[model samples]
Target: MHDFDWIYECAVIFYVVSLLGYFIDFLQNNRKANRFAFWLLSIVWVLQIIYFFVTLMQINRFPILTPYEGLYFVSWLIVTLSLLINWFSRIDFFVFFANIIGFIMMSVYVFSPETELLPFITETMTTELFFMHIAMAFLAYAAFTLAFVFSLMYFIQYEILKNKINFRRLGRFGSLPELEKMSLFFTMIGVPLLLISLIWGAIWGHLTLDTFFYFDAKVVTSIIVLMMYSFLLYMKIMKQEHGKKLALINIAAYLFLLINIFLSQSFSTFHWW
Candidate 1:
């Protein structure tokens, strides 16, 4: 058993309770329940942060290779995103959906076998730049996810308007202009972040590896994803494209981004999954 096994169990329990609270709010529109769930989720985030850092300190490397670690990280990201969205926007039911996703990830992690980091990776001559590269990449991913969520909100709002679905709560989603602007803003932020991450990754690669190729599956796919988003940004800003069509393009680009994630994982030479 891990030293922090109890912490992980507590986090899981809190996550389950938080999901139950969110479900209650979703069904009955209970603000108090929502607030309770929000705080519980916040606690879970704190626990996750504590556990992540403690493990990193113990392992002395980025220990995110195994399925359990991946699921935990994804779940934490979802909670973080959900909380940020709740704080920044008036989008209704987003928190509910986000927590649901987080819960599913956590459940799978719980059922999966516990595992350790790959020994060779931990023994690799990693530098601060390697950590920076990973950090920037994670930030870029978070920014892209935020953009995707906003773009998704745009579509949902558009459909509601188009269908004349008059659920009063639907008004909580920001207007199309707001959602679109937010999406663009986050994408702009993400593009530079990803570029910086790539730069750092390349530097670290050159420093540590015998042969560093830009054509590696992960790097190539990353560059392609970057270009796709860049093209979308240019189309929207330079060509003055807007509305549901642009949102659809943004959504499609994000889907491709998702594909790049799994595709690169499958074939990457140096990526630690």
Candidate 2:
């Protein structure tokens, strides 16, 4: 376990270095900085994978059963997805924002309660259904995090355009249409994944606890989050809404999700840390 901690700390250091590279790229539009960021993030990802498997071996199960572990996994997912996005889309700005979120999450994890193997594993948590439920749920949260970043960029670009601000100064931020497209694209992906996660969670609950739903605060807030994003997608598709309104909606939903994540553990029995 100490070895795993050491490796995890090393990965966090590399991630911070990568973030600095990205920040330099953002400020100066330097290609070398961008390349350094990509390479450094790649190294951090590999180290994190090592740390993940090591911790899993130590714990004798998945590493996401606790809040500390979950945050670490979520940060890993964010970085992995950001790398993929960068590889395919070459969207440097997207990668920047994504890693900014990743950096913040990793920083939080460094201060989070230390993760230790549980004294005993519960039968309910050991099942494949529960594992998939938790994994997919966290992945969905990661996707939503990306969507939030893109929506924020969209709003910033929108404001600049509406106020007739200097386009030259903000040109590196990417065009408004591109930002909007990415925002909607991520929302489309995250909503369906979240739905599937909820379905599997319900199935797991029914199989283990003989209950389809507990109506706990986490469960209720999760449903509301699902509905909120569903509405955002519906409005975009059916009502033909776009621009600031959609971006604002996405931001609002993300804020609510953050609240649910932080506060639900205190009040909800099912999802407590």
Candidate 3:
């Protein structure tokens, strides 16, 4: 059990590092950073393989029969697919998103056992899940914040080019397309995380609230944020939009999200104290 924990912790560390590398590569088009991240993911893959066989030997059967085991296996599959994509193509964005899923799966698997091991822990698991919901929300916000920065950069770069001002240093940051796409990738990462966070938050509220109000400020603003970002994604995918339009939308969505975050702290009559 201790060994399993150690391996998972180490793998998670490497997974985070690899994700950071991929993120940097996606934003900068840095092939060297991409190569480093790829190798790190490979290491994580190898670690998971080792952990799988070790646990299999310990249990004397395949580990896929249980929910936690299923999570572990699914995480492994995601990593495998991500590595394959990185090896074969230019879809580092997919790898970034895929590994977010992988990291989440592994995180769930790691924390779940503690909840089962102790009686009090088991009882509090639902509450812990609620906390996870909040945590994921913040993570989504953080991803969106990055998107906002890149989008703002794109906006600035566009203005520079539009004015016909050749700022040589601007090129060091990234090209306009690269900045826009980086913003897109960051938003892509945030959207699902925010969705999942909202789902979990809704479930908790439904269970706990005596009377639910759709018009609550937190709820309304959160939904608005989600809808706005979702629309941004739709335009990118379906409308094939580009340039200042999408960047502006992203910036707008993030600004609203920030407003929601600070304002959501207020206690309405319906909310818990």
Candidate 4:
């Protein structure tokens, strides 16, 4: 367990260095710098994989039940998946969003005055299926985090266009079409995973000691968010909406999701570190 903690600490250091490289790359539009950032990010991802396995060795079971482990794993999944996407597509558009999300979460873990792990979160509330369910939930949310950032950039670019602002820095990034498509792609992937998580959560809730309809405030808010995203999906699929409008909707959906996660954590007695 102590070794796992050391691994996690190393991961935080890698994340900080990667974040700095990403910032420099973004600011200077330096391809070589971005490549270095990606390499560091890749190393972090590999180390995280080792940490995950080490955790399994220590706990002798999956580490998905506790919010601390769950959030950490989900963030790792997001970065790993993003790296894979960039590798296959040869597109760096997701890199910025990925770095920002990764850095924010890593920072929270590193600097938050409390970083203790909760044994009871797993010992008390966890089930095999429930663990899998939350893993899916957070993984989807992490991807949505990346998409949200991209959508934000799109909207900012749109605003600049609308206002005839002269921001040459924005011009250096991917075009509106490219960013919108990427954002839409990620949102499209996240929605169904979130839906599955919702269903699994209900099943797990019923199996737990809690009442079937306890429906914590976070759960209700999450359902609402799911509906909101579903509506956006309907608009995009049936109504053929795309581009800036779709991007804006994506941004709205992520905001709702973010709020739901924060509020959900509030309701949870378990540590959400």
CA RMSD, predictions in order: 2.7, 1.9, 8.8, 2.9
Better of 3 and 4 by lDDT: 3
Runs with alpha carbons beyond 4 Å of true place in candidate 1:
62-78, 101-120
For 66-124, candidate 1 gives per-residue lDDT tens digits of 53565677677878888987887776566776577578767777788766655566555
Positional deviation of residue 5's Cα in model 1 after best superposition, in angstroms: 2.1
Give one digit per residue, the lDDT tens place, for model 3 in 1-273: 555768778888999899899889767778798789889999999999998898778655555433466567757876775577456644345566557757886887888753122444233333655666655665676577667767877887799989999665455456788778878988999999999988988887787666777788788888999999999999999999999999999989978986775556373444321
Residue pairs in collision within model 1: none
Q: How do the predictions measure up, each by TM-score?
A: 0.86, 0.93, 0.54, 0.86
Candidate 4 local lDDT, 25-140, one digit each (tens)? 66777778778888988988988898889878877777665445666666787788778877876445467666677666655554544334457655645577777678778878
- What tens-digit string does per-residue lDDT give for candidate 2 at 198-266? 899888787777454467888899999999999999999999999899999999999998977778878
Instruction: Give the C-alpha miss distance for residue 84 in model 1, angstroms.
Output: 3.9
The superposed Cα distance between candidate 4 and the true structure at residue 15, in angstroms, equals: 1.7
For candidate 3, the 10 contiguous residues with the lowest summed lDDT are 114-123
Top candidate by TM-score = 2
Candidate 2 achieves a global lDDT of: 0.84
Among all candidates shown, the one with the greatest lDDT: 2
List the candidate 2 regions with Cα displacement exceeding 4 Å.
115-121, 167-169, 210-213
